[model samples]
Target: MDHRLSPAATARFILLLAIVLFLGGCRFLPWRSSPAPRPGHGLQDGKTAGHGEEPRIVFEEPDLPQPAGEVATPARKRACGSPPPPGRRLPQVAIIIDDMGYHRRIGGQLLNLDMELTFSFLPGAPFTPELEEHAYQLGRDILVHLPMEAKDPKWDPGPGKLLLSYSPERLRTTVRKDLAAVPHAIGANNHMGSRFTEDRRAMRTVLGELKKRDFFFIDSYTTAASTGMEEAAALGMKTGRRNVFLDNVHSRDKICNQIGQLIALAEKRGWAIGIGHPNQATLEALTRCRKRLLRQVRVVGVHNLVR
Candidate 1:
């Protein structure tokens, strides 16, 4: 070490101090923890891969973070000024697409929608089982579309038709077969049973079996005089009916109009179920109007709508 400081020694010491100060002031290195990985929507609960096909990447939307100290209320009650009745809550809409499985392309399109729409498959349809599996894996409700006696003989209820003339034993066997064909069918609805659905004896047989199996019934309302719902209630079975048909006209614009009607009905009542077919127009209408429908009321699965 030098006893006396020289100009060169002093200058070197100053340079070393300046270098240390500069590094400290830079602050470029991160000293905080890493941010939490934002999970994708629909799989926030970590139950996707094991379930249905990864919810067909419809709208790759991320869940919006809720504000602090805030909780979500049911959409139906959000606009309520006064507290609803003890048993009453928000308005909900459950849309069911009937006549699936017959047309593979349209049925697949309906299944891809992540809205949890119910799919009703016609028994004996070529691809009923395959479509049923798809609906089940995706966590959507499935219903076996049972055919019954129609008013006109020319209407033709196709194969597996449940005729009114069949004995009680035959009717029970036929109903069982229809329910078994679908993988996860929780209920059954008539495809076309104007004459049969009105027959009290016939409906009792069908409803009795459904009660044992713990299934529900949805009155398609093919005819105004049908007694399916009343019979199911007598048997202590869960049941509901279609409030509207979205595609009786088979036009996109018409279907959208029908959806508007459904929303209006849902708002008036606590809940409503709209039945549609698996057609191009119906799918297009649903895809376009979902944003608006979801805003006004909660669009739920059919099972949720059952009374």
Candidate 2:
């Protein structure tokens, strides 16, 4: 108990104690990361529904496919919405732009055109109010492009489409509701009524309602079998039939060519009606063909051609 260590031995003992202290103080590095993920499972991307609840799996949506083509310019954007500047009737021609309200830029571009054209809006669309207001501000003639059943078995005519399955009363109610949706709507046209427009009974029910409201009808003539115009006339409601589909092919060349034909027809018959969509191709065609259209015949609103 009283034995003293030699100086060298004591020095060696102290060095050993320092080495132990330094080794014991050092642990894992500060920059060390967590454990590697287990195979086939991640660190739960989802949270528990509540306390003591199992976590639910969260899925990230796959990217949707892009549309086939991008429309740089709308197919038609004719300067629209008025009659020939007073005293210039000049064998009127009216262009009607259908399928409005779905696309914002196209609709606005169509409105921007300085020509007098009609805009037919789709009721119940998300942009219905905005489109109606813009068209209204520009004093454009607004028409409700009423959706109707087509001959195709699988084609979806979209919301508010008229079905042959509807009874007369049901049809009337639906028509009224649609017409009311677009304030200042002077008339309506069928969206795709190849089958419904051909049924005389259905046309009568539809025409009868239009007659009651003093609204005009424009038969899109989606099919040659359509009797929509005849029934409207039978009911004594003012009506018009599509003379030419301006952009059936949805190309600038085809649409402009169609517009040329429309002008010639207008000169011959005193009036012509052309229907087109709010597309880049149609817009380009109409814009390019503006001067020729003005010289060949007067471009008037759809209402001017109703008679």
Candidate 3:
């Protein structure tokens, strides 16, 4: 049926329709809308507080030791050179050949040696990068042999040497430059630093720079009073000292004896790092006796011994 509403009733009807539309649109209004409750909120029916709570622990009786017959005993200690008592264990001995990159012949001779030798190259030397890359490629560790002022002025380590007179900034700059000159060098060791190494301030500066670069330091122990270790330790840098100088005497017999001394030290201390030059006697002795030396100890790299 066609029904017409009066003006007042039409106005009322329109107002009612508008109110319904407004209520329907309220779902999209942020203020009137309510977000769904998140999972694990105990709003869901049939869920209770602490529904997944773990059960209270109950104490148990203490475990008793097994019978002597069921327990395993450690093996007995065997005598030295007695096949290691069936398990392999050897003392670690690290050999480092310092003063490299000076003469190609000596450096090449050292490279030819079968034993794994760490080559410490002097920065700014003619063959520094060549020898460093050669050693690195041969599965040997490379070290930057940093020059420092020696106790005797007559002994010149090399150009751009860090001297005691230089300020800390100059010393750090020199060390950084030297390190950059040697390629593939993972660490650095002082070269003839009997005087400079003794200066705690200077050594600290050098070691601080090395530590910043995440490199290690090996003190050649040129002098008994060297402070490289002390400074390095203060900076939390990985460090090691030369336990034996293989070529201190630079004679076949003396070097052989020194090698023996190195083995003895390695045995006593569980590890030792020996530093030697590429002297004829040193290389000769090392080449001749490396096989025999391997039998007594495991010759490793300087980094292995340090870290």
Best by the TM-score measure: 3
Q: lDDT value for candidate 3?
A: 0.72
Tens-place lDDT digits, model 1, residues 173-259? 998887877858899888778789999999999889888878899988777678998888888889988777777776987787777
Residues 1-307 of candidate 2: C-alpha lDDT, one tens digit per residue: 8699999999999999999987777764464455533321221222223454322211111121111221122224323223346666678888999877665666688888989989998776656789889889899888998878767644445567688999999999988887888877889998767778889998898778778778999987777677888888888888888877777676898877778667656756688788888778988988887876786577788888775
Task: Tell me the spans in candidate 1 whose CA falls farther than 4 Å from its real position.
Answer: 1-90
Task: Tell me the TM-score of each prediction against the true structure.
Answer: 0.71, 0.70, 0.71
* Whole-model Cα lDDT of every candidate shown, in order: 0.73, 0.73, 0.72
For lDDT, candidate 1 versus 3, the one ahead is 1
Off by over 4 Å in 2: 1-89
lDDT of 3 by residue, 262-283 (tens): 7766766688888787667887
Relative to the unseen true structure, what is the C-alpha lDDT of residue 127 in candidate 3, on a scale of 0 to 100? 62
TM-score of 2: 0.70
Q: Candidate 2 lDDT (Cα, whole model)?
A: 0.73
Q: Which candidate is the best by lDDT?
A: 1
Return the candidate ranking by TM-score, descending: 3, 1, 2
lDDT: which is higher, 1 or 2? Answer: 1
Candidate 3 — which pairs collide? none
